[model samples]
Target: MNTAAPALEMTGLTKSFGTMRALDEVDLVVEAGTVHCVLGENGAGKSTLCHVVGGSLVPDEGGLRLYGSPYAPRRPADALAAGIAMVHQHFSLVPTLTVGENLRLLRLKNLPRRVARVRDEYGLDLDLGARVSELPVGVRQRAEIVKALLREPRLLVLDEPTGVLGPAETDALLATCRRIADSGHAVVLVTHKLGEVARAGDAATVLRGGRVSGGGPLAELPPERLVPLMIGRPADSLDAGLAGTIGLAADEGVRETGGEAPEAGASGGRREASGPAPRALRLRDVSVRRPDGTTALDGVCLDVGHGEIVGIAGVEGNGQSELMALLGGSLAPAAGRVELGGRNVTRAAPRERSRAGLGVVPEDRLHEGCVPPLRVADNLFLGRLERFRRYGVLLDRRAMDRAAESVLTEHGIRAGGPGALMSSLSGGNQQKVVLARELALDPLICLAAAQPTRGLDIGAVGAVHSRIRGAAASGTGVLVVSSELSELLVLCDRITVAYRGKLLGPVDPAEPDARERIGALMLGAHAPDSGAESAVRTAAES
Candidate 1:
């Protein structure tokens, strides 16, 4: 432990947004050449504390010292100048600029060489000439990390860095973190995953209800103790939604598909009942081409039966986004067709698809799900605004407010009220708003949710999963596309793998080797024939 002085220290930090106390009398300490993990559930003041430290938001009260000197950065530039860099959970790159161009904008001397050096050192492979918007979500996330590392800050802060990474990428990034710490840099990792905390951290701090509840060396406070502190409850007390995440047996309410393992690649092996369930959605030979002329989805075919939840598992860039776009009707397929409720919707517009009872919870919630500037009431009634029309023109404000109030309560969203601005809510609450609105529509045929709980806490993840399963129980087919294999196993009736624009296996999660089989499919290790072969392999090892 090279602790001449603490690299960063905060004392009694407090931040308030109107009536909400985001961080209350919080304290944190990070030592040089060590990884300090901040563990917290959503709204536990983790991001707020980070923002105050990074100078993006000024704290209303409290004090901070950098390397034993009084420090208060008036702006992000000041923090940067003080050798502190933060990689936010969200990317902050210009969509129009290329990766290299974005790096050069930092005005760091010898930009190309610095980026090249950092990329090579950290095992980051990015196309410098590719525009930010042209890259897949995963690659863009990598670009963000590379951009931050280019600063070579003494104190590095990363918020949920592995949330979007695949297994290999996550392992590589963790290894890089170790190297960064060994080289005398202090790393502050803000995450909700306990596994990461156990594996990567030297010291850990647990936050609950905007206060520091417990913290100590990783060895002194293992995950078994840390989880309860973060959640403010015993791990065993957790419901079905979160228990399975940490390898604990799920609670009784959590549905588990049971039977002898389904035959791999066999549609017959789906955990759903064997009788002919009506098809809710279908895609036939769907192909998509990116604007940069790459084949994003190559002749993909899929289907989801009513009363079923189909999980799509793959590395982030493997046609998931393209598939989502096709389902949402945001992008037209270059070939093939899409059908919803047996109606050809291949050429339907987004609004038309929604009209046909196709609900979508897009991955990029900040931009696609709801308008942040709008009031909660307006956002809740966004797409269905027509229903509040009294005379086909005059709006019914009172009706909308009442409806919004009902949704807020029914969805269990913790916010001021319907009058509150959507931007004022935390990330998890924002997702609840999206889910409430989408599910309230009673989507008859299909619900396409991509990374529905990307940045939510365990409680929020549980809520989202329960709601999705409830919808399936009501006979609505759901397509859950996520990078988390564990999540797929928890929620889907039949888990499938997508690889390099191709669809493979409808593996039953009941299979003993489901996780390993999914991992193999994601890495393209198994080559079940594209069409019929994918349809009939037994879930058991063949």
Candidate 2:
């Protein structure tokens, strides 16, 4: 090891919030010109550690040395001046400003020239003139990375950077990490994806319950060795054989490849249907248009039978958002019918749809899923406060709190209490709260979840998958829209590719060539009925 004074070193670092110790006597070291991955489940103190390093949260104990020099930052600006930059899990860009304008906030001269140079150098293509709010999550993430890179810091910290990215985008980001490391910079990559660690990490540190559990170089510590440290149990103990069945282990090659080859009856080992189940949701010739009159979804015909999990897969900005909005009752279709439990509810209001047994987990949980300023209990009953009403006027706060407490415990959510602010919880716990609230709706006809596991840890992923599968087993049709193809492959019985606002084949995940076919279809290739099948066959032969 060519170790010439480590890039960063910490000893006895500790941080706490209220009575909770978010970080406890944590010790970490990062050598220059290397990529170090920080692995942990949500609430495992990964974000807290990052905050401490990035100068967001001051550690209550211990000290840090940067390049063998005393390094203590009072604020993010101080950290930036000291050659440290951080890209947060949630974006930090001003939503109303254009990308170019946001870059200007960094005090760079000749904004267009600098942006173009960095964009070309890092392969981060962003529309500088576009408003931050108008961009999709993936694009916005790219913008954040670009902004961080423009700072040209000696140390860079990225938290859950690939959580919202597609497979291709994820690959590109990994490459960028490698490039940065090769240029003699140090990178701290905080992620839950074992595949990413295997691909990009040189060394790693695993944290459990605010303390260092285990860590080493990636070569010596593979994913198998890290799993137990992360969740305090072997991978096999996860619900539904999640770790093995879903291919979360790096050795399974599922991460490198999109997913595992299909097994017999590959509905993720779910029970086979005895007969034709009643339809839970149906979209017949459904079409939607953007406010500017462009087609967002065109003639999309789809069906989700009771007790089935259907997945929608595509690159972002390819109609997935519009489809979710249509199903969630936030957007009206320009044409066609939307049927839920065999009842047409295309024109129904959002609350009406919810009352009719439709549960929606929106993509942006922070903004759309819950009210941050509200208590966890209040958020749990949001949009359905009438359920907790006493008589027809006064709110029954006690009943709401009790029910919320039960839901939190049942869903395995860790929070201060029912009275805790929703904003105070970690990304994973917040998602669990949303899931608990939506899934708790009895007589639920259909559940629509968009990017349900985004920014969540492996443990949380297994829990979300178990919940979805359980919902399907209970005769609730589940529609999962995700940018992660591997996630869809492992979770859905049927997968459809969306391209240019059009729906393609609902291919079986059990098929041998399913992954290849899905990839082809996502790139606008024709389905099997068209001439594209022969093209794929020929390409394989060659």
Per-candidate TM equals 0.91, 0.90
Model 1: per-residue lDDT, tens digit, 397-512? 89998988888888778777888899877777788898788887745578899888777777777777778877887778888988777777767778778887887887878778
lDDT of 2 by residue, 410-501 (tens): 88888888999998888888888888888877679999999898877777887788789889878888889898877787788778887877
Error of 1 at 300 (Å): 0.6
Q: Candidate 2: give the clashing pairs.
A: none
**Which residue runs does candidate 2 get wrong by more than 4 Å?**
1-3, 236-241, 244-278, 527-542
Alpha-carbon runs more than 4 Å astray in model 1? 1-3, 239-241, 246-278, 528-542
Candidate 1: what lDDT?
0.79
322 Cα displacement, candidate 2 (Å): 1.7
- Error in Å for residue 152 of model 1: 0.8
Quote the positional error of residue 503 for candidate 1 in Å. Answer: 0.8
